[model samples]
Target: MFCLHFLVTSLPFNELKLGRRKYSERMYAERAKPLAQYTTEELYARFCFGRDNIKYIADLVRPKLQHKTKRSHVLSVEEQCLIVLRFYASGTFYQVVGDNMGVDKSTVTNVVKAVLVELASLVNEFVSFPKDDQMAHSINVQLVANADLIITNCVVKWPGSVHYAHILRESALYRKLRSNRPNGIILGDSAYPLLSWLMTRFPVANTPEQAGFNSAHCKTRCAIEHLNGVLKRRFACLNYLRVEPKVACNIILACIVLHNIATRRNVPLDDIYDGPEPDEMQPGQPPMFAPNEGQTGRVIRDAIVRHYFRLMT
Candidate 1:
């Protein structure tokens, strides 16, 4: 007992203390410099995403992101935005955001949630199907004037993996297209099974006639694939979401809205020449849920192959 007490008392107060970082030290000593210091291009090189997007989002949610306290000053809307972007860009932890920004982790948490909620509110405006009597998807964007338009819902909440064919039958947009414009045609890749409303290329173009149809289909379908490439290129978060599925869904729509905003403002998008998202090799045969097309569906498919593609060629 005497020895224990002697050792305890002998220890210096500093030696016995825990090494927790002070809030001010963290706030003031952040290693990651404030992004606002950089030019827009410099900022883009840093986050690689979300920096260009903030200008559009700020007016929408900046007011809501603000907090003020007499006892302790709150993070400004701009500060919160920088925190949110840094978080998404790096997929770094809240502690990293705090240490880098000189804010408490809780502050970072609140800022992101507040901003997402505000962004979510404007989703319908930016992310909607064409309200066209007909439609399309894989989250392709159609630019009009200066805004990004998502012609289909971009949700991964659908059941069963491997892009099941039946999912189309159960899809809301599919039904919308059918009811609104039954005569309208949609071009799809072989990953999608053919239906009356959706058309796929000839599986194996053995004959010249079949070859012509596949060529026409490939040329048109490549454009949407290219759209996917550009969209994913600009937003790194879409390539690999760090948030929960629900949050990811909102983020996806939020990005679509912002993409359009960037377009309207004439902000340069990521160059397509930078390359596409790396593809994952499927380990096994893709599971199939394709049911037989109806007589009408087959007739429509054949007519397009014969009339449209053949004539176009």
Candidate 2:
């Protein structure tokens, strides 16, 4: 070669066009329309909450979330809540959510974290174990819902591999039921340990009465299943989380708080499908060894079967 390096070094900087590059000036974006301009259906489709319900949520968090500074282009609490809700409803990447909301990815992340913290604080007030004891896993969330599909109690901190019975055992709700106890029983599946306050399906229906008990118990327990389906279908983010486990836990709790608000306000489920029927059992659940099963629980289950399900036979 003819000394290529010498030729390149000899070239003038101006001839090489090595002058500093000029970047395009930053252009701020705006949503096509303000949130309030959207109709009820549009709000539900994008945010998974009706306009009124969103206003309610904004109001709930305003005391804490309202911007303290008078900085330019500061986001309002309404927009902040909407950003998080959109992320929850779409379950898409943060950049995508930011694009929709006319925000940068960092802003979206910050807003979600702030609004999630505010919403999660309301969980104790919005979600609790029903004193009436009419119940019911993943993160292994242990949810207890009433017949109305309202989530009464939820334990959200457990890992995915944790056993349902173990989660229940570790939960404060479990201790409360154990000590104080409720007149009505909570229905669970074979995956959970049977307890005096919790009734699981009969392992072996030795009699028609036992078979009938299993059938009715299974049917009635469908409420919790339905509640689970409704919850996931409504908040698509809960299907799979992209955040760290600690943040995911807070997100789950916040979603439950929002769910309770929607349910209480009769916000319609706008999803194309409500998912599978509530009566259908979730498939592929491996059976667990319930060493903690107690005779007291067996006696109570037998009493219910004798009194209620025996007649069906």
* Highest TM-score against the true fold, candidate: 2
Off by over 4 Å in 2: 1-27, 32-34, 132-141, 270-293
Task: Estimate candidate 2's alpha-carbon lDDT, on a 0 to 1 scale.
Answer: 0.76
lDDT of 2 at 266: 92
Tens-digit per-residue lDDT, 1-313, candidate 2? 0110111224456755976444344445664344667889988888889778888999999999888899656788888989899999999999888777777788889999999999999999998765553333111126877776678888888887766767777788877877876877777777676777777778889988899988887667656666777878889899999999989999999999998999889999944433334322344544442444467889988998778766532
The models' CA-based lDDT, in order, is: 0.56, 0.76
Q: Candidate 1's C-alpha lDDT?
A: 0.56
TM-score of each: 0.69, 0.82
Residue pairs with backbone overlap in model 1:
27-102, 146-264, 148-260
Q: How does residue 295 of candidate 2 score in lDDT?
A: 74
In candidate 1 the C-alpha lDDT for residue 139 amounts to 26
